[model samples]
Target: MAETSITSPHIMQIVGYKNTGKSTLIAALTRSLTFAGRKVAVIKHDGHDHFEMDHEGTDSYSFAQAGADAVVVMSEKRTALIERQAIPLEDMIKYLSRYDWILIEGYKQAPYPKLVMVREEKDLSLMETLQDAVGIVSWLEHDKSESMKDSEGLVRHSVHEAEDIARWLVSLECHEEKRRL
Candidate 1:
């Protein structure tokens, strides 16, 4: 993706332990937002391994290994890269400001508005650490056709349908708009 800068951007972080449907929720949310004509940006935090360059033998990887700060790898099909230095989350947000909203995956510890996935009762503790959680996505038992009624402080939705999550996001944006005005 071509790089662009953003400012005072709205962000939503999806966080939970492994297999709690965090990734699935993000995918649904993105699809929903995209269909709604809202531009969406995404960022994923990979806690398992150090950042690895894509296309290992590609020229871009070779350039980065040779100390190139930014290398763009392009083919007729697609393009990607491995880069040096860790860009802060804020900087990434700045880069994504052109989009209407940013949906971040797996930054459970970061201070951002969030739509956290909680599969079990034990995982709810994550809510304490998150700065502000706007919503929740759960795979647990609840009415699937509509938003869950039990979400006390925030909205809740089933992660099984992209449209449902998308509608929820739209609702969130609407609510935020009202609060801002």
Candidate 2:
């Protein structure tokens, strides 16, 4: 592992199976945070073998083809980095430390405070398997779903409760700042 050259940022993740509203929650959170004048960086964990972030004609891709090991392309609008191999979440977190908050989309096994999105009680089983879960986001607000108790201290929120979730993340950022000092 490469030595981490940056401080650990406030990190959280939304974890769930396909069609579980993970993307929805992430979008809402991003909008809310940006509106509140906070810089938020998101890292999506793609579990497919053919996840591509660069096109063949791009300079970054051309550099990679030339065995540069890592390629970085910077323009007035943005910068992109491409590496030869996958990077672990630990290192990615450091690389993104400049942001006020970092939200990950997958990596259920990652040991971070997680919000589990579920379609029904059956999917609640994932809570038991995850490394950590602080909250649950559900689209179903029926009595049956509410009756399904989550892990102790796990707060339940509706999928549309983006404002509430964003506030919670703000609180988390404050807490993380104290921890680093």
Candidate 1 overall Cα lDDT vs. reference? 0.72
* Among all candidates shown, the one with the greatest lDDT: 2
List TM-score per model, in order: 0.79, 0.87
lDDT of 2 by residue, 54-171 (tens): 8898777787888898888889999888788888889988888887778999999988999999887788888779877888888877587855563678888888898999988777
lDDT of 1 by residue, 64-152 (tens): 77888888767899766455767888888887778877989976767887877868766666766777787777776664413344546
Which window of 10 residues has the lowest lDDT sum in candidate 1?
1-10
lDDT of each: 0.72, 0.82
Positional deviation of 109 in candidate 1, in angstroms? 2.8
Q: What RMSD does each model have against the real structure? A: 5.0, 4.9
Model 2: residues with Cα > 4 Å off, grouped in runs: 1-7, 178-181
